[model samples]
Target: MSGWLAIAGLGPGDEALITPEVTEALAKATDVVGYIPYVARVAERPGLTLHASDNRVEIDRSRHALEMAEAGRRVVVVSSGDPGVFAMAAAIFEAVEVGPAAWRALDIRVLPGITAMLAAAARAGAPLGHDFCAINLSDNLKPWDLIERRLRLAAEADFAMAFYNPRSKSRPEGFAKALDTLRQACGDARPVIFARAVTTPEEEIRVVPLTEARPEMADMRTMVIVGSSRTRIITRDGGPIVYTPRSVPA
Candidate 1:
């Protein structure tokens, strides 16, 4: 590879969320490669070349970025939220010269960003302070049966749960399926935190019981957090927050 691989994270959605370092990487890069939606987030940077692709075309995109770098071009692989969290960083590494010749010739740097789970947790007043696990209910990449098994284990262990790709417009029933699994293991009253379009326009956060997390309440843009048995839902002066106790020195 010709240049450094900056796995820059575009924080949340606001333009102000972009850090000086991230901006510099974008400012200096000759080629910027990323998923289509993430690449669109980059405002017109003068003379920057962009290679955007479909969402599922991750490996191809990574390979393309590497090819550009091998051609003596500085390339920055962009990812929304943290590049490592279900994003480009892993794909880049996977493609980075795995062979002795490949590993010896490439340079890569992983830059992290504000992940949706953390952003959503912040809006909900810390529902993930203690032991927690994130699960994607989508069966597109992973099988639904195994996802169901993780849901059972997480709920049974009373772990705080953050769901990425919780639901989509077409197969919106995934969240419902997850909730059903959780409710079956943890009972119906498990606290559920819903955040829509976090940090962007039309951001919304609310807490409901697990049994009450309706399909109408979520979509592709929504990230859902389901709390454990220790989670508490507070309604103070009509503002809602879901709090999970943190264990200090005992």
Candidate 2:
């Protein structure tokens, strides 16, 4: 049997958020590969082999998946949220690009899913309804200077921002630096949302003014959204609804 490889997104924490295309691909896969947690999300079956590895071994994992596919095994490489968004899809392409030329001819497809940014935005009443940009705040592959520049530029452009990999046990100071940079650049009371483990049983959403926002409010699991100056919050008896107007004034 001719084998193929698919890079699929499992969506944020909720299984229901996973796209039908990804589910179908997973069900048909003879081998599944991903980070330990993401691979754990897939159920075991008689015919499927699961390959789980450390989070930092993405390229290694991608090469393994490609090798499996080359050996005539249908493979699905899983990722949390969208595979194209800071996930396995890019890593797979990178591996393909640098590996054997025959690897380029292998069948490969990317299946998108709901990213945490969108899921968090949906639960927060559309903070990203207007122009926005998503940034990965971790300084792992990139330097902190670049991240700071993007943050400042995004603030200056008045674009709403969604931040991923905001904080971790090792890099606890990054988020704090980010908050200070935003506070200095934006210089306004726009709303900032802290959405933790969104769409799961541990979900927690907190809305606070930018001035009052703290670094500790966010972690690796948190999706942080900072509104543009044009963003607004409508308060009611139920709760405040945060959204950016569809139109911008001249």
Candidate 3:
């Protein structure tokens, strides 16, 4: 069939960070499907249809993209940040796995882009330079207990961490609890970096000690990183630079 589906990441917020591959996919797409804001990023072009949907409807959106592809339409499924990282790529695969057998043979590709964690890390000067883990604190797909357990374990293992969807209107208490758990497990002085709206006009980056970190510091637009024991902050005339050294004590 001439139809194919491409799940492409638009990167964090900057148009410059969007990869050429993703741009080409969009240019070739007859249909572009994604969250409302992400779909809005694609310029209006002749012969291109934009399907913007609500958040939390990933399965339905994936199915729509697949259906459009099956009809011989070149479709691009857009996502912010890397599609494979807590984004549409997994949803697409999950739909395919449980979907029709024919879908398994469809031409599908996942084009990676700069994820929010990486973008946040770079803006903060490489707090994730060492071995690190990424965690989604939303608890929308998983249980709160599981999130807490993972946070404790990550701290015990001394792994630097990047967190996504840290706080939302409905889940404000979750991040507060997470901060408390991290403080109890990781100690009082570990640095926590809150990077909001990275690469966008309203971009703001803040670093605070774990003890001083408050739940209100994060919002849906924020990406949070909690440093390992070795994460360091260097204060310069411009600002502070955070980084984790490559070597550790023997």
Candidate 4:
């Protein structure tokens, strides 16, 4: 089969953060499929078709990319941030698992990019320097009860946390409840970093105590990170640096 499918990450928001491997795949792709904003990032060129679709249609998008690849079209599935992190790579695999028998034989690849969680953590001086865990705060795919359970458990284990899809206009209460959960579970007044639109022109990074991290301070565009008990702040002339110690003294 000459056709292949490449599930690629476009990085967070900055074009420069996109990996050279993903850029090469896009250049070779006969078709690009992704959410509207991600597809918009790919430059239009001759012999390349872009398929932009709505959010919640991941399965359909995956299937379409698979079919196109089966038909010998070089297809690239794009996602902002690392495609495997709450993004399109898993969706593509999910479709392939239940798809036609021939799909299993198709050449498929997942190209990595800088995920928002890491990008956000980097902007905050490695608040994730120690052991950490990433969680999707959006209850769209999972129950809120499960999310809360994991939140409490991660806190109980003293793991620094990075949250994605923290708040949206339609789901304002969830993040508020999350903040409350962390405050009650963590107990200590650790730092919370809110990195919004990282690497973009509108990028904003705000550091505040866990007690002051309001739901309103975060939006869908924001990456929220809550530090663990071992996390410390280095106050400097410019700004404070938040980082978790690399070791835990037993």
TM-score of each predicted structure versus truth: 0.93, 0.99, 0.99, 0.99
| Candidate 3, residue 137: lDDT | 94
Please give the lDDT score at residue 133 for candidate 3: 98
- Tens-digit lDDT string for candidate 2 (7-58): 9999998999988999999999999999999999999999999999999999
Clash pairs for candidate 1:
none
Residue 181, candidate 4: how far off, in angstroms? Answer: 0.7
lDDT of 1 by residue, 37-112 (tens): 8899876667788888998888888888877776678888888888888788888877774633554476677777
* Clash pairs (backbone) in predicted model 3: none
Q: Alpha carbon lDDT of residue 14, candidate 3?
A: 98
Residue lDDT tens for model 4, 194-228: 99999999999999999888889999999999999
How well does candidate 3 score on lDDT at residue 75? 98
Query: Model 3 misses residue 172 by how many Å?
Result: 0.6
Off by over 4 Å in 3: none
Error of 3 at 42 (Å): 0.8
Q: Cα RMSDs of all predictions?
A: 2.1, 0.7, 0.8, 0.7
